[model samples]
Structures are given as C-alpha cells and as structure tokens.
Target: MPLRYQAIGEALRHTIAARPDADALVVPHQGVRWSWRSLGERVDRVAVGLLALGLEPGDRVGMWGPNSAEWVLVQLACARAGFILVTINPAYRRDELVHALELTGVRALVLADRFKSSDYVAMLLDAVPRFGGADQGSDGPCSELRFAIGLGRTVGDIIPFERLLEEPDSAPFAHLETISREVGPDDAACIQFTSGTTGAPKGATLSHFGLLNNGALTGSVMRMRPEDRVCIPVPLFHCFGMVVGVLGCVAHGSTMVLPSESFDPAAVMASVERERCTVLYGVPTMFIAELALPDFGRFDISSLRTGAMGGAPCPEDVMRRVCVDMEMREVTIAFGMTETSPVSFQTRTDADLETRTATIGTAHPWVEARIADETGRPVSRGKIGELQIRGYGVMLGYWNDPQRTAETIINGWLRTGDLAAMDDQGRCRIVGRSKDMIIRGGENIYPVELENFLRTHPAIVDVAVFGVPDARLGEEVCAWIKTSGPLSAEHILAHCAGRLAHYKIPSHVRFVDGFPMTASGKMYKPGMRKAEERDPTPRIPVARGSERAIKERLSR
Candidate 1:
C-alpha cells in the first residue's frame, strides 16, 4: 500500500510539495490563510527558533491553547526539529495545566497571550513557581524551560511568536532535511494527556507510525480524499483533533479549516459553508448543538461528504439526521482512547446502518479487537468482555511512567478499561467503561444501559448514573438527569423499574438542568458531586432547560 513514513515531518513535506500553492489552512480571525508552501516555510522558521532554544531530538515542546495558526505551526515545528509535540488543553485551570506540563517534561512551552479574559502567560508563570520539582528530575540541572508566544492581546514577558520567525531563511531550516532523514517510524512523535476525569492525567505517547497509521487507516475507512475539506471545531490538544483531524489531513493532502474558537456552532457552520467543506470532525455534542441551531437548516451543509463522530457516543437519532437530513455519507462512529492514537475502531464507508448507528464499528485494517474476561481469557463472540486492542494505533505507552505503562500494556494488547461485545461480523459494541460499572448488592450494573434507556424517554434530554456511598449494599446507583420537560423522581424510577432489575434502578433521582462536562464533553461527575453538595436541592428547575414534565409525569 506504499505505507509508512520516515517520520511525520517527512510525510508533511511531500504533502506541501504536492500542493504547494493550495490553501492548506485557513484562520479567519488571525486574517491568516496560508498555502502549503507558506505553511511549510513557517514551520521551518519555527523549527529554527526551537533549535536556537536548545531543543534536542525527542524532547517534548508543549503548546497550551486552542486551534490557531500558531498551535498547528508549533506542532509542525516540533516535527521538523525532531522534537515531540505535547499539546495541553487550553480550558484547563492552574493545577491541571501545571500537572500535565511537568508530567510530560515539557522542555519549552508556547502559549497565547490571553484568550477570553484569561492570560495564559500569567497563568503559567504563576503556576511555575509552585511546580516544586514534582518529578522535575531529581538529577543535576532540571531541563531549562522557556515560553514561546502565540496569539492574544498581551503577553508580559514571554517571547512573541512573531519574533521567532524573523530569522533569515538561511538560518531558518537549512537542516530540516537532515532532521527529517534522521527520524524513523518508531520515533516518539507526539504526546497528549487524557482528560483524566477519573485520575491524574497520563501522557499518551504516539510514535510517528502510530499516528500516521491511524490517520491513513481512518482516512481510508471514512473515504477521505485529497480535495476534502474538514472543519475541525475541536481543539488540537485532543486526540480527535490531532490524530483524526490534523494527521489525517496531512496523510490525504486534504485541507483543514480551523475555527477561531473551540466551539461556536454558528461560526463553525459559516466556515464549513464558506470553505465548501466536505466533512465535519467533532464530538457528538458539537453536532447536536449545531443541529439545534435555529438557522441550522438554512446553511448549505450538503457539501459534507461524511462525518466522523467520536469523543462521546452519538445518539442514533443524531446519526440519522446527520446522514439523511444533512445529506452526508453516513456518519462513521469511531472508538479509541488517548492510549490508541485515538483510533482503533472506526465505521467504514461501507459499514451497515446497524454498525454505524449502534456500535463503534470494526477495528482498523491493521488493528486487532477482542473482549476478555477478568482472568484475561477471550470472551465468546456476542458476549461482553473488557475491550482490548493491539496494533500500530496503540501508543508507545504512557510517558515516563514505567509502572503505570506496565499495568496498562498487558503482554501486547492494551487493556482499554472499556467493556464491549463483538458480534460475529467483528463489529464492537462498547457497553460501558469498566470503572463506570456499578456493583450493587452483588448485582452488576452498567450506567450506559440506564442512560440509554433514559434517552428513550421523550422528556429526557441527558442523563448520568454513578455509584455513590451506600451503607448496606456497599454502593447504590444514583441518577442525575437533565430534561427538556418536567420529569419526577417517581416517574424516572418507574420507567427504569421494568427495563432493569431492582438493583440496577437508580435508588435516587436528582433532577437538574445541566450536568458538569469536560472540555471534550465527558460528564464531569466530580464537579456534579460538588454542585450537588452546594445546592442539595435538585428537585427544582435549575438550568434554563429544565421543564415541568418531571413533576407532571410523577403526578400522573
């Protein structure tokens, strides 16, 4: 298949040359739209800047911000300089930002001046002093860290990103070819931490081949093309953004349209229509909100060839509208954690409706997918087991945590901690996260079953189920629901009564308009717990969307 690149940078060089004059990126807010040629030149200049900063091969350079020209440029610069790129989420607070940066041994950081009244420069500088050698290498001389600047209104002391580009072309990237030649498929190319809703974030290490393989394989599965333009509304820090969005674009020589903000459905819609975009890459929430836009139907979204839905489950209804109403090729449902370069399973262009709508679909061509029991024995086909995968998509293991890595990587397969059942046709249906499972009175319950059942209720908008402290059963199921119309505790319990066993039924029902969510759209249960404590009354209309159906349904 003529696959495998020397490194990501080398592959990108060929892409730029093939379409040197083609518009490779469009950043409307920055008034920046660069062709592949110009983008390549800028990448080289940034590489020179990093080299001058004394970056070594395989060293990690951190970028903490949204998807901007500078964000993409920094990643490319790392590739060109043989430095591994580490992307940190911009929406993170002080502690999270600090933990991720230090955990990955980020040698240098490139940040924005300010975004939405938050000054990143001040944020990092203030957080740096408190770092206190939290694994900052007990050895001689901790790696010297510097800040490279990016977009924003102000950056007090950091070096401006533009200044780094002022170097002469001769000094810019004369050795780019040398660095590219030195890289191999196995070289650590990039690393990004998971959202860590459960525990401290672990850096997922992606090699050049792992990333490129995921991109190439997904591109083929989704039938992405060189002329296709994908609207990347998700942040580049996420696996969906980097592996499927950026790396995929590079592999297929496709154009990537970057929005000014992480999420503005209106602006995103405008960008897609304006650029004649052929695909939309986003989490399910983004698509749901976009569909909810009052003027959403007014736009000419018929240009969309296909959609890749991941990060969270895409409701079957959403998939139907995306495919039938939006005039898309069927939306492909993808599944993988940060540990798998973000794509081990993806619905192919030829996948059936059931596979596309109900399951995360089959493993990629080079990947193996299976379910196993607690004892590591493979589960029979059609039976649920812990989902495990082994392939080029599997990460190089979490960064710098040998013990944790050993724990996660068993033999060769990566224990994904996700529960799934594979059908005879090889379609993998993800049932629930292993940790999210609730064991009550010796009965096992998966929240996804309850959540899926709740979604069937016309009044229900969203739902979450978690196991809270229980005196007798060890842990009892508690359900937090967000509804469009009024619904009551009794009504929820009754509906869940027949569909599930008594132990699986949520013992407590809390009605709230909104549940806390992470930037990538996973429900933030910890934050929800905090909010529950502060309010203690989930019975009333809280968030704006709360309706009276709960009370009425119960009164009936």
Candidate 2:
C-alpha cells in the first residue's frame, strides 16, 4: 500500500465517520470509555478551548503527564487545532522541564498535577518563576508560556482541566471545522525531545504526514483490524506510545486500551484480561518485567495475539518466551530513532521466530534504507556500517537548531548513528551504536553482541556492556548485570571463557539490582561509565583463577 499523505485530523475524522459507534478509547482506571464519535466530539471541544485561550496556528502546546485520558485528548486536540504538541517526559524535573519549554517556545502547557514522586506543579513553579506571578504573560524565564491547564488540581492562576471542556466559547467551537480545514499534512504536528548523551536534548520536529503514515504502516505490518483491541502500557510522552500505539490504532480504526496511568505489570495483565485485548505494545525491559511476575500465569493473557517490541534491543531468550509462553506468536521487533517518527523497519507478523528475533525486518513501505561506510558511501550487504533512512517518516528538523539539523540530516538522508548490517534479503541486524563500539587493542567489539551472549545464561536476567578507559589498550570491556539471584563475577567469566573471544570477555564485572535508565527507559550508558570513573580501581582482575591465562591471551 502507498503512504497516506493526509493530515492527522483529517484521517481521524475519516475513521470516526466510518466507525461512528466503534470503541475508540478505554481508560479503565479513570472509568472512561468512548466510541469514535464521542472521542471526536471531545477532541473538538478541547481543540476549540485551546483556540479560545488566544493561541493561533503553529503555536506550541506542551503536554507533561503520564498515560491518562486527558493526555490522549490533548494529543489529538493539538493536531485538530494546528498547534505543535510538544511532549514533555513525565520523568523530567525542573531543569529538563524548563529546557523543553523554552527551547520549543511552548505557548501553553497541559499537565497532570502529580504522578509517582514528581510534583509537576511545584516543578513548573520552580522552573518558571512567572508561572503564577502578577504578570503571568510578561517576559521571564519561560517567556512564551502564557497558559497552564492542570489535569487534576490547580493552584496560583493555573486553570483546572475541566474548564477547557466546559468553556462556553461558542465562537471558536463553532469554527472548528473551518480551522481544521486550514491545517495541512505537511504542518508540524509534534516536537519530541530526543535525549542525547552529549550536550542538551534537541526537539525533533515531526509532521502529520510522517506520523500518520508511520502509524498506518506499523499497524499494517501487524495486520491490525478494526476489531483489534490494542493494550498500550508504554508512556504516551514517547513516540512509542503516541505514534506507534495511539496513532496506529486510529489509522487502523482499532480500539485502544490504556492499561494504567503509567507502566504497572499487574495493571497491564489485568487490563489485557478484562479488555480481552488482542494486541500489545511495549519495550523489551517491560516484557521482561511482565514475564517475571511471580503470579504471571494467573492472568488470561492468552487473548494477546500479536504486539511490537522496541525502544531497546530485544533479547532472543525473551523473544522466544513471549512467543511460546506469552502466546504472542506474531510479535515483531521495531527499530528507529525519534527522528524517523520512531520506526524505520519492523518485523512482519508472519515472520518466523529466528527472522523476527535476529533482525529488524526490511524497510518500511515507501522508505529507503541503506548501510553506509564512514565516508557516507553505501556499503555492500552483510557489512556493518551506519544505517541511514530517507522517507516520508523522516523528521522535518530539530526545532530552532538548524546547525544540528544540518549535521544530522545530510542530502535528505537522516543518519541513524546506529551501526547495522543488511542481509541479501534486506533484513538488518543492529550492531551497537557507532559510538558504543569498543576499540580494544586494535580490535572492534560490539557491546550488543556481547550483551546478547551474556543474556543466554539462565541466571542472567539482564546485562549492559560498555567500554571503560584503559591506558594500554585504549579501552576495556566492563559488564554490569542484573541476575535472578546472587552470582559471582568468576561464574560469569567461566561461562564466557570458551564462548566469547578472550578480549571480548568483561575485564571487570559488577552485579547490581538495576541499571541506570533514561527517562525513555533506555540504558544510560554514559551515567554508568561516569560512576565507574569515580571508582579508584577501574580495572579489576578478571576471575582470580583465569586471570593469568586471559591476560596472556589479551597481551598477545
């Protein structure tokens, strides 16, 4: 099928017209369920209310919250109103919050009062001193932020979210149809802040054209139908939820089931059982957690037929279990960054277990993908190189940062920075990130390859492999592992003794209950390495007995 070049609002209206009474959204925790027609009506009411706040087309609107019915409303409303929706990570604190607001020039913000340990209202007050000040619209740290809508409770000039739905704004509400007509497919629909290991985060601008089609294509790969109920446990702030999970359902006219406010394993399983959801979506770590639940089999998750796993490298062991044990035989593995509307390639539902677990499938429909050498030249199949993509799914650019945009998107191709190799069949296997590759004693070592090998051990639940500084070899392998129980570094080393190359074996091993994670749930390698740098003895001898033999092999 060719890509759909329609605007999100246009596509949404089409679906509502076709499936007027079909279940569109269900938030069991909030006791809310809406049909397509009802969702469309509420979405329009919110859009009109936003315009009533004196915001115009192209203005930025930020959403800072977890997965709530309100979050979904604001997400679709922004598209309907022609405002750029900037998704703020629920994990962001004062500094990160302010940075995203100021960087995107967000004119209005809709947020939950509090979730988990973070007090969003207090954080906003601290980040923007003028938030509730006398001159609310006056110049200050967050100069462009003029309005605030609180999802739960309001304080100090912040308006309660209910007011938006109840706002008796007849004029804007009446003109909603006309307003939506003015919005085009190429208009900026969202700005997602991409987490960078270095410098500050960049706001990746995405268009309705890209997001709408990416979702449709993703849904098609999973063979979604109008009756499919998709259980989404991922955070709505990320593309994984908003685009892949939400938009995918809308594009396919499928029902969406919000499992919980945030990711809770029990809530997800319960929602699956209660809603009888046929599809599921989550990151690999999330699947691992759900499968590890003590009473995991108590829930009838057999309703699950298919799903997509992305946002981190999926372990082969876990993938196999999801198929056989979890009954998700048609599950797929997705790959891409935020800049590519989050998915450039995805495994097909009909793919065999090995094809699904070993590769990220072929390029998305109407998208061009290639593996390129360091010089930006295309590399032959079966050779590792940087993966680049050119398609409708590519992001417009980084918001207000042309210099960095120029550096990232060259000659219309967005450089993914991830190293990968394509097979003759076009299936691509991810090698680690180009920057994550370890160079030890003139040899190149991919951390993901090592991590995958370590995960094969029954005792090892999860692992993160990265390089640490070494005076002689330039860098050395270090592994941090989360296991099912107490396991020694010696035992881990003995397992890798013959399976892995000598230099690839972790020179230092530390067992931990958890690995540092970014707001988006990716392993924060830089943070782990920073903490390692603080340790006085960065290099520890590998497994006492095998130390001499391994040292001799590495020295040679």
Candidate 3:
C-alpha cells in the first residue's frame, strides 16, 4: 500500500501517543531518561526554533554530532519542518566537514562541541572560511539560507544548544502550520552522500516516505518487539544507523540507548549490559572489536539477541563467532547503499549457515533484486552481473545532479554499482563493486576521486586507487602511482594539500615504473589489482578457521 503524505510524522506521533509515558531515549552517562511524550514535545520545540531560524522548506540542515537524545530530536524537527537532514559522520576531519557542509549548502548545523578529545566546534570554525565562502558564492556551495548552531559547548562565536529551544514550557508548540503544509511523498527529507562508482560523492536524496517505509519494513522483517531496547553504537550520520537504529526503533516503539559520543567497546558493552539491550545494532567492525576485548566473556551481553551485520561483508568466522561467542540468536546479513535508503536485502534467520554466511539474502519486502548484464537484461541465477533494486526505500534521486541521478535510477529501479548474483533460492550475494569502489571501515570511496587528487602532485604521472583486503577494516585503500620523475610516500602524502579526507587518502602507496594497459591504452585496473593481490608480500593474516571450513565444504 502506498503511504499517504505525512506518514513518517504520523507514525512517530501515533507511537508516542500510544505510550506517552514509555521510555523513548535512555542516556546512561547523564542518567537521564525521556518518555515518548516528552521527546515529542522537545522535537516540537526544536521544530519551532528551526522555523524561527529563517530556514526555507527543503533547506539542508547538517546534523553533525555524536548520537544523543538531541540528535533524534533534531532529525524529527528537520522532518517536521520539511528540512533535508544532511547527516555528518562525527569521525570526519576538518576538510571533510567543510566539503560536506558546503557541498550540501547546509543551512543550519547541529554540532557537538566536543566528542572525547576531538573538538568539533574548533573543526567547524577552522572550516568556516570555506563554508562561509560558499554562502556568498553565486554558484559555489552554501544555500542562500545557511547558518550554524552548537550542541555541546557554549563556546565563543558558536550558538549554545540549550538556547535552540523556543519555549520548552509551552504545550503542543507552534509550527503546526508548517507540519500541516502539503508534503509530497517525493519531497526529500534527507540527503545521504555516497562516494559514487564514478568517483564523485553523489548525494542520494531520500524522501520521508523512503526512510519511514524502509525503517518500518526492516523492523517488521526483524519482528522487533516494542519492549526491546535497541543498543546502537553506530553513528546516526550513516544510513545504516539512522534508518535501522533510530527510525526503526521508533517505528516499532522500542527504547533507544543513545550514547553521548563515538564508539567505545567498553562503553557499548556497559550500555548493553546496563540497559539490558535486546538487539546489538552496529557494524561488523564494532562487533569484532567488542569480542576482541579481553573482558568480552564477562560483559553479560545476553541482552543482544540478534541484529545486523553489513556495510562490509561479514565473514563466516564473524558470523559463527557472533552466534557461538556473543550468543546472538541470528546475525542477519544485509546489503545496500545510501541510494536505496541503505537496505536492499537482509538474510533470513531461517536460512542455513552457508546462506547466512554467504548471501546478502532475499530482496527486502516491496523490493526486487536482480542481477543484470551490461545491457540491463537479467542474467540466470548464479551468474554474476550488476545488482539492481527497485523499491519504496530507494531514494527519489541525487541532489542537484539530474544527469547523474538519471544514470543511476532508470525508470523505477536503482542500478546499484555492485556486481552480484542470485542463488537458486533467490538470495543475492554481492561479488564486488562493478567499478573500482572501495569500502574502508564502511566508508565508500571511488578510486577516480582519489586518483584525481593524487595526479595533481608534481611528482606523480598517474595513480590508480583500488581495494586491498584487510583484517580489521574489511578493505583498505591502496594507491599505485606511476611517478613522473620520483616521489616518496611522505612527499606524495604531503602534497595532498588537505584536499582529500583521511579515508579517501591512500593507506598504502606503491610506486610503479609502468602500469599494464589494454591495446586501446586503457589501464587494466583489474590486472593491476590481481598482480598486487598475488604479490604475497603483505598478507592480510586472516584467521585460518573459516578458511579451513570453507575449504572442507568445497572439497565435499
């Protein structure tokens, strides 16, 4: 069924009203708790304040902070006021922060003053020159409507968060008119940027309907209970965390454990144990880190019944360890990108270990996943081709890039840049990105972007960025540069000029005399990657247990 307009806010309101006094957000550090009613009221106040900030409808507001109760409030307020919430990963450096804020032309920024020792306020201030410049430019960056507000610290120059509220004492708040305004099902509510296959960061504009329906459907598939405490250590900036963690929990009327800042394995363990959290919601890196802790067995993590494993492939060992070691009931495998509101397939709990460990599972309800040839024709099951998905969760399109959006979303389906295959049981398993896309610690990067930055170096002739398998990060970025004259890693890195973000920068730089090419003179990127993969000098040193198991099965 097609959702009526305002379905997202309506869902939130209905859930809040259902149990007005029920706990909505829990903060262990602050020892604070807010009921759904109170949360809604706060959201209303924030919405009213946002409207007062001179923001136009559809303006992008950068929610740049660690996960907190206020984070959820900001998102709700943005949605209610018809603002596009641009999520900012708290881990980003000053350069990254500046680019994202300017690229999206963020009208208002919701920032945390400090997370741990990292001061986001200082970072934003340093980047203010670039960000401020964008606002004045006729065709550069900032929207006509743009400004910033602080969340954590009441520092000099930055607006304090406490003052963002209009009149907290007021009931039902104002901006009901804004809420009642005509909202289209296609109006963008959020802009999620992914490093595109073409090596440009393309902002995927997801509508209110896309996000709300995706969250609701995912929760339904997982059979989330209203009483469950969903422990979320992932940053809400990412689509996985926002839709699956915050919105999904809200859709199911579940309580959210909102930690004040970025991830700490101990903090997560403590939060889960303290809250008796029923679902462990985080990336595979987080899960692995938690299990690697010496005190892992002592952390009473039985509260983590089951949850998601994606962003990067969850190895069979990781899956088994989560089930056998962490005691999770079923660790569901997922596959998607920001373009699809971040979920295309989720492994069924009933599937066998191979299916659970290997495939990304069947297409999500209301979604169709198919492996198609270059011409967009479907290939037979078990044949590798580009994976395409058509669904409600798919974004409306990219922001401000109609041509790129047209290339990505043809008709109703999204052409995911991932190469994949459907099994006999119709489960989709991702083979690789169709192009040179690298996912390092769940941050997608296109090789061309990095190569373009690298090529600007006086010492560089040509550079190619590719993914190298890593034990911890799943994939680490490796750049093979053919130097014009001569260049050291230090020299090359120094010349980056803060143009590329740290993740986008190369972790391993290999200087080569020449790169192999086809007769047409195009670089054989796969051949280069293959040669490097076969080099065998720096092995990734994966645990041999899963290797042995996989070998045994193949032999059978």
Worst lDDT run of 10 residues, candidate 1, spans: 540-549
**For model 2, which pairs clash?**
none
Q: Encode model 1's per-residue lDDT on 75-96: one tens digit a residue.
A: 8888778899988888877778
Ranked by TM-score, the better of candidates 1 and 3 is 1
Ranking by TM-score: 2, 1, 3
lDDT of 2 by residue, 1-556 (tens): 7788899999999999999999999999999899999999899889988888899989999999999999999999999989999999999998888899999999999989998899999988877766566554555678888898999778887888887787565677668878889999999999999886877999999999999999999989888899999999998999999999999988999999998988899999899999999999988999999998999989998889999998777777888899988999999888888999989999998887777767889998889999999899999999999999999989999999999999999999999989999999999999799899999888899998898889888899989999988898899889989999878776777788778788888888877789898766789999889989998364455632245685554455
Specify the highest-lDDT model's number: 2
Model 2, runs deviating above 4 Å: 134-139, 167-170, 536-540, 543-548, 551-556
Top candidate by TM-score: 2
What TM-score number comes out for model 3? 0.76
How far residue 8's Cα lies from its native spot in candidate 1, in Å, is 0.5
Q: How close to the true structure is residue 343 of candidate 1, measured as C-alpha lDDT? A: 87
Q: Deviation in angstroms for 132 in model 2? A: 2.4
| C-alpha lDDT score of every prediction, in listed order | 0.78, 0.89, 0.73
